[model samples]
Target: MTIPGGELFDNRDGEGRLRVGVLISGSGTNLQALIDACERHEINATVAVVVSNKHDAFGLERARKAGIPAVFVDRTAYTTISAYNHAIAEALDDHAVELVVMAGYMRLLGQEVLHAFPGRVMNLHPALLPAFPGASGIKEAFDYGAKVTGVTVHFADEHFDRGPVIAQEVVRIAEDDTVATLEAKIHAVEHGLIVEAVGLFADGRLEIDGRKVRVLPER
Candidate 1:
């Protein structure tokens, strides 16, 4: 299968698998979710590598424990954002990464990285986006006194959480819900939605039409 731009869609060998590369900054709960799905064969994708912008990120430990190749490409060591993003793209290519997933990855990706991977990059945001975006979305939602919040899995674009949403799972914000409680709910939805969206992408069940996403039934 192929898209209009000559991009391969649903192209796989006889094994019917997709290779994934995960980027992380802190705890790798979503990465763990993907790993679990792959282990159980619940998704047709495999985590090929885990990359981190922080050297001491706990996600690195998680990846190592899972016997996956973990790399530290510290952004602080680079002089500019573009330099760091270039290095990241190189690392992903070195690992032959097919799809790039940002899970708890705190850094804002540069245009270089976005263009390098194009439609192959995905990200999990802790809020139903176009609402609360950025680093502290959960806290922002709680402070704003929103009655509902959720997680969004979207294709990564140059802008912050403004990409085309692939999937979303809503979580009700109770009247008594504090920042911590809201964050917990956000995390739960993030983990589940990310895995589900990745599964759809792996199975060639996702299509992007302008700013909208179309999910097709599995063949």
Candidate 2:
């Protein structure tokens, strides 16, 4: 997909690292993975800020411990979803965020935020998408008795888990594996795959063409 102005958008900071704003609603294991990746220089990016709809979310604590700005935008305070999303966009804008990572963020983002950072939002799903696309992906896949399920990192559109796929890694289910074991395997894959996808975005290697994402050669 072409960018808004038909030009590749580069929003890197002076340090040449992408400014990332991560949105989370839970414990933030994936967010921690990203923080670790940035700390180890595995990715050319930094966690500029973290936003959460719930004030009690542990992800906020994770961000605080990492010294990144953690913002709590209470959904109940806003009268409309648009107002809430605009508030979220405002928070990201305050940090000059170039990429938006939805790491277990429960609410769907509206156009107010999407228009602000077109083609720059990413999300992680527990199951390889086009199969189980919602919050119960792990349980759904396990109940369906699928032999293999995996993680998917993809660009986020207005719809739920229906954007361009960027990266995916399969995890085979062992006969003796319980749902808890399957979930553990999926989470493991999610941590690495999300980091890899973020790294690709930071390196300017991901190009969107229609509904598909292409990874360019390493620079």
Candidate 3:
């Protein structure tokens, strides 16, 4: 996996928090975790907005309930992927998004958004990336009978689930663990690891080095 070249300024919210835009396509469990972290002051950030490609995504509701602006740019409304992604980028920029987090966002973002945010875009994948990638990651890991699996947070590059890894936590596969159980464990780990990874990014604690992302010691 190649690391995209670029860097972001250390911008802060009015109170020194990071302003983030979360993109999602489903129930938004990870989105909820980030919101909870914000509310608890665990992460030095606030969600500026939440963008969903699916109009009916529960993430939009989650955002509204948290008093965060929620926008849905229906992918079907655009003829091309770049056009759709441009609208998403506009939505994020319009809200002054400093970081873009793919909580459960299913679509691979096009170059429009990738260029718009550069190193500021992050994605959470279900398996230890550079391993099982794509939508069927969890299933693939299970079928492969791996003893251990995990989640990864990485910068979003041009390819799918291929980027410099920011953070990861392992989940040991129990002998009795069914796919459902393994999935639950993976998600549980994701809830925490993703939050930690985003917090690190917001704090300027991450640096890209080829295929490696070094998380710097907190100052």
On lDDT, the candidate that comes out on top is: 2
Give a tens-digit lDDT track for model 3, residues 1-219.
222221344455667788889999999999999999999999878999999989999999999999999999987899988899999999999988888999989999989998998788999999998899999999899899998889999999899999788998888889999999998998999999988987887677888888888877766
For all predicted structures, in order, the TM-scores are 0.92, 0.95, 0.94
Worst 10-residue lDDT window for candidate 3 reads 1-10
Worst 10 residues of 1 by lDDT: 1-10
lDDT of 1 at 76: 82
RMSD after Cα superposition, model 3: 2.8
Q: Which of 1 and 2 is ahead in lDDT?
A: 2
lDDT of 2 by residue, 1-219 (tens): 532211244566666788899999999999999999998989988999999998999999999999999999998899999999999999999998989999999989999999998898998999889989999999899899999989999999999999999999999989999999998988998999999988888777888999889887776
Alpha-carbon deviation at 12 in model 1, angstroms = 6.0
Candidate 1 yields a Cα-based lDDT of 0.84
Say which candidate scores most in TM-score: 2
Clashes of each: 0, 0, 0
The residue pairs that clash in candidate 3, if any, are none
The CA lDDT of each predicted structure is 0.84, 0.89, 0.88
Q: Which residue runs does candidate 1 get wrong by more than 4 Å?
A: 1-14
